[model samples]
Target: MTSSAVDPVRLAGERRRIFLALFSALAIALHALEFLLPSPVPWFRLGFANIFALLALFLYDGRAAWSVNMVRIVVASLFLGTFFSPRFFLSLSGGILATLAMTTSRKLGCEKIGPVGVSVLGACGHSVGQLLCAWWLIVRHDGVWFLLPPLLLIALVTGIINGFVADALLQRLRRHPPFEDIADGAHSDV
Candidate 1:
């Protein structure tokens, strides 16, 4: 059989698996590194691991991105030994919400808005998830509504930073020869 006639299904599946594995590893590394960074707010994370999420969203389909995101959160929690804590559940809720929001946005043709917009939207969703969980499970305090402004401001700032970082990395990767080859299916594995 001619090389051009080779089955594309197998090749596509291989590429997807490779991409998933690479992004998963990157997410784990970022999550681990976040533990080393000193932060004043206990729940306030730099979201360094989100870079991988954004990358996966841009590179692969939404389903793939969401799957990778879920895996990342579960695996990271296990690695950090926080699998059964309130923080873990809060993280799970926020992560799932954020992923769904991003995936929906992408499906709605919002991908043209780029990484910054996507990150901003994801951050807002994440904050909402966290607030809902806190209100329902932890605080049960109506006064907690007062914290919205500050929390939103923080989310906006961090989201922009994360977005810019993801955008820059995506651009850089696009320019790399190896990534170009992968994109072109010249390399079977990501």
Candidate 2:
């Protein structure tokens, strides 16, 4: 073999990090892009970035999903100049709760629910988390929760959208042998 010939075995071993990095970057880009889109509600987002969190959850596990969420929040906040601000806290809380919801739903209903179901739950969780945090941090009033109805409606809509997207991508990825191996934890030494 040539001096620089690549080794398939070694590449397989590094797929975890490579996949993590890929998902994180895609999420971060989506997050930053979403910032520029106008929202019907103030501080409300379409949550395009969360699709990758679902991807990470399905492809690996909760830890990978959490990592993607955290990286997307911190890095995207830095890029958008919202780091260490109230907005940052909102994103952080939402991301954490979303990941938790995705993983829990996946674990409890793996045989019953697919990626779409988990993604919807994650989106709902994210909305709830952000709403509660916003109330606690900014509104500081009991009446702030009145927004829950509309917010949840929006969450459901967006969640379904994101869920479908994630499902389609997951279906395609699952058919690929390398990704199947990665998802199955068949790759060693990562």
Candidate 3:
């Protein structure tokens, strides 16, 4: 194929891969950074890394979001020496559910929901996922239920913060031709 004749289909796929990889690294970095900060609530993280997954989901799709999330969890866990541990599983479950919630909300709400709504839902999902896992694996007691109220409230606050960040980034990134070019067929099967 001529240089100008380069297949858009292949090009789009390549661009997506590149973005996914970049998102994963960014997520990992943020995850590590959050780990260093002292938690206001015990065992609670600000979840700064999820912005990239949200970005990937909006710019691409759920699969891309999942890829970024999974990579972030696995790589960050390994880096933090938590790989193959309960903490890793907790992180894994939370990331999985968060991405799912975001993707589902986006699909169901369509034009009605913006980044904030999607992100809030995702954050709530992540908290619920981790809470359930803790109840099942660690706490195994009814008393663990008390954590829900606080966790959900935290999730709401954190989600709104993350959502606003994602919203600002999305607005700016969408205006970018290179990003927009690859994202042109974002809704299409690539």
Candidate 4:
């Protein structure tokens, strides 16, 4: 094929891959940075890495969001030497639940709720998923239930903070050509 005659399918696939790589890198960096910080409580993460997943959900589609999330989880785990470990599974489950919740809310015409609301929902989902994972694998008792209220509160605060950050990022990105293209619905399949 001529250089100018790029296949549309191939072009779309390439774009998706490139975007996924970029998003994954951002997530991995954020995850690493967060890991370096000392937390007062064990198993407590600010979840800043998820902002990129949320960005993908809004900029692309559910598939793209999930792709970004999974790539981030796997690659970050590998980098941190946590791959296939219990911690890896916990992170994976929480990330999956959060991405699913946010993407589903977006796809269901919940735009009125905006990113903030979606983020809170995703945060709640993430907390619940992680708690469930802990309950099953570590706690193995009803005592784990006691952590829910506090965890949910933390999630809400972090979600709002992250949501504002994502919203700001999206506002600026929307002015750019690629994001504008997506906003114009040109990448409906994305």
Candidate with best lDDT? 3
lDDT of 3 by residue, 103-179 (tens): 88887887688889989999999998888888888889878878988999999999999999998998898887657
lDDT, ranked from best to worst: 3, 2, 4, 1
Q: Model 2 compared with the native: what TM-score?
A: 0.88
TM-score: the better of candidates 1 and 2 = 2
- Candidate 3 accuracy as TM-score: 0.93
How well is each residue in 86-113 modelled by candidate 4, as lDDT tens digits? 9888888888889888887877754565
Q: Which stretches of candidate 4 lie over 4 Å from their true place?
A: 1-13, 184-187
Q: Which stretches of candidate 1 lie over 4 Å from their true place?
A: 1-6, 176-190
Steric collisions counted per model: 0, 0, 0, 0
RMSD list, candidates in order: 4.3, 3.4, 2.2, 2.9
* lDDT per residue as tens, model 1, 37-103: 8878766777778778888787666777787788888998899898978888888887887887777
Model 4, residue 57: what's the lDDT?
76
Residues 21-96, model 2: lDDT tens digits:
9999999999998887887678688898999988888777777888899999999999999999999999888888
Candidate 3 ranges with C-alpha deviation above 4 Å: 1-3, 182-186
**Better-scoring candidate (lDDT), 1 or 3:** 3
For model 2, the local distance difference test gives 0.82
